[model samples]
Each structure stands twice: as structure tokens, then as C-alpha cells.
Target: MRFDTVIIGGGLAGMACGIRLAEAGQRCAIVSQGQSAIHFSSGSFDLLGRLPDGTPVTDPVAGIAALAESAPAHPYSVIGAERCARHAETAAELLRSAGIRVAGDSRRNHFRITPMGKAKRTWLTIDGYLTTDDADRLPFKTVCIVNVEGFLDFYPEFIAEEFRKRGVECRFGSFNHPDLEQIRRNPSEMRSANIARVFDRDADLEALAAELHRCSEGCDALILPALIGINRNDSLELLRARVGCPIHLLPTLPPSIPGIRAQQALQHRFRALGGEYFLGDSVLSAETRGSRVERIYTANHGNIPFEAAHFVLATGSFFSKGLLATPDRIVEPVFGADTEFVPSRSEWYTLRFFDRQAYQAFGVKTDPALRVIKEGKALDNLYCAGAGLAGFHPVQEECGAGVSLLSALHVAETILKIEN
Candidate 1:
């Protein structure tokens, strides 16, 4: 089937871009595998209305946020932060309208104690959002934080100490893995969703539960990661029924399932709007002739022959790594496309994983028009968005999904020339 747009990589950026283009009345098809990367998402959308240079704005939308970025000439000019914030709100509203009500507001969310009084860092809550607060002064006798097996993040010690400092007794447990040593020796300070990645593979749930049991043995309240299992609703109902303690779910970061749920919600909306889906597809590369896309090749699939259309590549960075092709150590994954990326990985992430700056860390080099550039030249018909476009720190302002959606919307605006 010939699609007006064939978007590869079904993760956040890809999903966002595809949904936007499809909603813009373009015939679009999204190619993806089963794992949407939504499985690991925390689900809260960040909509900060101000840019980093402190440029004042109204409110954040779903696909974009407001932020100050450095253009070639200016020293830190404001750009996508507002755009990102805006996108988040729109997408979230779409979710709420779908009956899975999500919460967001112009007001900044606050941090608070978990029901288990685990992590010292406060959490945020809107009306439909998960409610959390600083548990420092709260008199909770026994509270527990959950963990998982082989999961490379979640700090039991850090959380325990924080609760201790706050004068609250707390317990740290693992829903990720059972091995204390494995959880203890996680080298990656940032959490990995490896266990969650394998959630639907028909593994032993009882064993998984036994491991959770091992971690939660003496806890009164069990604080598990949000989107605890493969099935969101089922996980909520099942775990609540099975676990004896008071069950509370907390939001997680990138590779978050909530992000994926946002994606799914968008996809359903897109399809309802007559968008086509091409699951598990690969476009070999673009065949261009004289500053225009000629045709797209696919191995064992079909071809996308384009004469004069634009393309948005939201292939994410190393974590999602759709843009990273690992062939014989040659590096770069997006076919033979040259990326005007940071010189090295050192510039990509800050040393501190907990630092919010690292998450919005990387993507493609492009102009303000969202065009991918290499040596001062645009890639003709191609544009980049999402985490694949580079250089916005998502963790810093919690703007990952917002950026993904906004830039895609920006691409749509360019495609449609929506003059605001």
C-alpha cells in the first residue's frame, strides 16, 4: 500500500511525528515493533511555559515546551521549550478525552513523600495525576519502595537514607529482580527497563512475584513503579489484589510505559482519523536525485516512491538508538545519513544521572525549521524531530515527550504552513 508518509520507529518521537502528520490529513503509516518503548514511560507530561533564558510564555502544549537555546548567532535564544510544553497538553487532553484521564496544569508540580516514605525527592500531582508529597514530617511507621530484577537503577540506599533523614522509617523492595546483589550492584545509576522489556514474553509471574515478595517482606506500604506490569489495567488490579500491603504506583522516567501509553492513545486516535499503520517495517534508505526524494527502498518489504514530499525522522538517540546503526564499529544507524551530532558521547549526558539535564540530552543537528543539516546544507526534503534531533535536555525540564510532539507539530506546520 502506498502511504503518503511512512514513519519508521514506533517509539515516542516516531509515534508523535506520525500522529501529527496523520492528523494533519495526510495519509501516513507508522512502522514499528511490538515494544513501543511506552512500556517504560512515567506518563506525566511536562508543560513548563517558560524558556531557559527565562523568556515568559503562556503555557506549555503537548508537543513542545518553551526554552532558550543557542542559535548560530545569538547567545542562548528561546525555542522549542514552549513548543514542547504545548504538545504535551494537547496529547494529554487527547488521552483524557479517551477515558484514561491524565492530569497537567500550568502550575509546576511539587514533590512529596511516597505512601511508603521512600525517596526524599518530592513528586507532583494534578487532579488526575498521581498524588505525592514530601514525607519528611509525615509519621509513617513502615513504608516500602519497590525494585525490580536486573533493573540497573532505583536506589534503595539513597531512598532509605532520604527517608531516614526525613525521620521516617522506610523499606526498599524490588519488583524488577529478586537478587539483592544484582539490584545492589547496578552500575547504571539511571534505571534500565530490561525486565519491563521482557514483561510480555510469558515469563513466570509467580517467580517474578516471589522476587517482589523477597524485596517487600517486611514492608507495610509497597511503592511500585508506575505501569507495574505488561498490562496497565490488569497490573493495577492484579497486584492490588495479590499484594497484601497498601499498593501505590509512582512515576518513572525515560523508557517509561506511560510515554508508550501516550503513544498508543495517539495511534488509536490517528487510526480513527484514517491513518494507516505499517508495523515492523523498514525503509532501506532514500534514493534521491537532484535535491528531491526519488524512492525509498525496503528489503523483503515494498518500496515508498516519493517525488516531492517531506520526511520527518524522529529516530531517537543511543538509548532508543534508532538513529544509531552499529555495523562493524563503523557507527551511525540511519542508513548512510550523516548526522551533525555532538563530537563525542561525553557531551551527550552529564555525569550525574539523576540530573534532569541528561534526559533531554541528544538528537540530530538541524536548523530552526527542523531541517537536518550537514555542513550547512539541508537534507532537501527531510526534517528531524523528537529525541533524534538532538541538544535539548529532557531530564532538565522533564520535556522529552513535549519536545517529540512539538517538533513533529512544527514539521506539520511547515508542511502545511500554519501561520500563527
Candidate 2:
């Protein structure tokens, strides 16, 4: 089971990385346990539109600029207006390649591209004040963000207050959590995994539909917690059919996510091109010496090892245990025994709470190249992208798939360029 690259997580970053690497004629595969995170995605990407210094953002350039200075250890720290534009251009190119169209908004963003490649000038704002316009206009009257219950990731009071302060009509949907006691009492596959499993099943999950019907009673659209109970096509169908509103899915934050299928949807093209899928596969360990990584190990039926001239660690964060956020949550432990990770602490969760709530979940701590870094050290042969990287909160702002794609593309380009 050798490959040019062995990506750890099956989420957005790993899938996207695998796709591009495979498309570049590199043999790539990803191993993972659960589904991806984008399944519960609202599917709308955006930026916070402000800097840590409180500078209001009129464009992506400024927002990215702020990210650089603040997030010196995460993602890119040098993305200026021009580079941001370059990012947008690169994203448009990638989208076009992916058979999707994405344009900027005439109201807020500078340009607009769609999956369909339609071009239109437009304006967008929380209120009808002509706040911002972009080259591409946003569709729908309200931008709905979905959150789940019991998860308690996003505090209801704070979110509702923020929306109220902004005068935006935000709605929520009810998702079931592991009533572990109740479930243990009535052990069944459907009830074993909580709401996420419920959404994936066709029958017996009707309780979720009933609850969704209740929570989404009169809201224009119901934004649900990340893919936990995300029915994808069915969710959109049911919400549209029963709730009668534009359903926008906000991807659930890391560690436990339900968007694996969404990643599959986006990765279908690459797989169709002959990419090998090692679903439920994993990396046991890697044997590396010096700056080069020689081989890695895994186990399915027997001991499986993979050899690669080059490698990419799109595995993910402590939650996903890519970088081992804590003791209980660990990953392959790249580098060696001395490579320690974040301390185990419940309080590691920041105070603002909502501050860490969004889909990106604080992102990953990386350098400009989007390589995961601990103490100013970039994990050689290891590059990171997506929610795992710490920087601007994508959940709080508009996480244009562009950011992840941009970092992923840039890293891949640099890797391929350097390797050749």
C-alpha cells in the first residue's frame, strides 16, 4: 500500500490534498476512522471582514493581511491585498477545474464566480444599507448558519445576540446528541452514534425529522450543526419541502464531524481519474531519517507499510489528533518521541467560547506556507490546511473554500515544484 503521499484525515484538507496530489499524477491515499466535517457545511465561505486591530474589512486583501500579522504561526502571515487577489484567482482556477463556479460578490467581495460560472454584479449586506457589493452577488435574502444542540460548541445566547446586534435573521436546528444513558439502555446501531448516525440512516431516524420539523418550525431555513445528522440531499430536500426555506449547511467543527460524504462529493472527480481510496485505513507510523521521509506503516488485515519519496501530513489537529492537541486525543505522533503536543486540559477551550465555535474551530497553527508548526518548527514533509490550522476563525467569518484551497494548492504547487 505504497503511495506518493499518505494523508491521515478524511476531512476536507486530506481529501483536497489527496485529490490535487493524485491529479498531479502522484499516487495518494487517505486513511481515517469517521466521516468528514463538510457534510454539515452551510456551503458558503466568507471572511470576518476585520483585523485584530479593529480595522473594518472592505475586501479579502485586508482580512488576509490581518490574518498574517496575527497568525504568524498559522497559515500565511504575508498575504497582502495583491496576494489575496492571487488567492482569489487561484481559487477561481481550482473551482473551474473542479467543475464548479465561484464569483465574487459585487456588494461585499470584489468578484463573484459560481459553480455554474455565471457572471453577475451584485450587492450584499446584513441590512439593506448597501453595506458591500462584490463582482459576484450573493444569493438568498438571509445567510443561515446551522448549529446543533447539546454539543454546546456555540453558545445560543451569544450567537443570537450577535445576530441581533447585526440585525440579521439567524435561525438554528435541533440535532440529537448521545443521550449515552438512553442509548446504552436501548442499544442499537442507529442510536449508538447519536445524531450523526441518525441522519445517515433512512428509517428509525424519523425522530430527527420530527425534531427538525419542530425546531425549524417557521424559520426561513434551518442551519444545522455540522454534518452530525446531516442528510445532505435529503436534508436540503426535507427542509425545502417541509420548512420551505433555503437550507444552508454549516460544516461542524473538527474532532467529531459528519461531512465525510461531502468530501467524497468534491473528491469524486479525482477518484474518477483513478485515485485509490483506502477508506477506514490509517498510518501506523513513519520511518524517516534526516529531512526526507522514507516509509510509513499501517494495519488493516495484517501489518501494512507504505514507501514514499515524498510525504504530506494533512492529518489534522489535536481534536483530529493530527498534531495531538492533548493526551487523550493523539495522532501518529510524527517526528519522534521528543515531539510533544498541547497539554491535556478541559480549559484549553477558550473563554469567548464562540470565539472557537465556528466551522474552522480556531484553525491550525501554521506558517505562511500552511505547514503545521509548534515552536517555530515546520514538520518536514508535513503540511497542513483547513480547520486544523489556527488563525482567523472560519466559523465566525465567511470561510471561502478558497482559503483552504489556496493553502492546499499553494503547498501542493510548492511541493511538486520543489520535488521536480
- Summed over model 2, clashes come to 57
The sequence of per-residue lDDT tens digits that candidate 1 reaches over residues 1-420 is 566666656665666666666666877766654455455555444443234444432333321222342322111122344444454456555455433555545434434333233432211231222344333444345677666644444455665676677665776655543333443465563243444444433354555555556656666666566534534435555555556556655555556555555566666776886866656555556766665454565544655443336666666656666555332221235444555444555554568766544324434666778766654566666667666665655554444555665566667667666322
Give the distance in Å from residue 184's predicted Cα in candidate 1 to where it truly belongs.
20
Candidate that would win on TM-score: 1
Off by over 4 Å in 1: 33-37, 45-66, 69-85, 97-100, 112-158, 171-222, 225-229, 232-246, 251-266, 302-308, 325-338, 342-362, 396-398, 418-420
Worst 10 residues of 1 by lDDT: 69-78
TM-score of each: 0.65, 0.59
lDDT of 2 by residue, 231-319 (tens): 33354455446545555433333322323434545567667756666677667676766545677776672455666655666555444
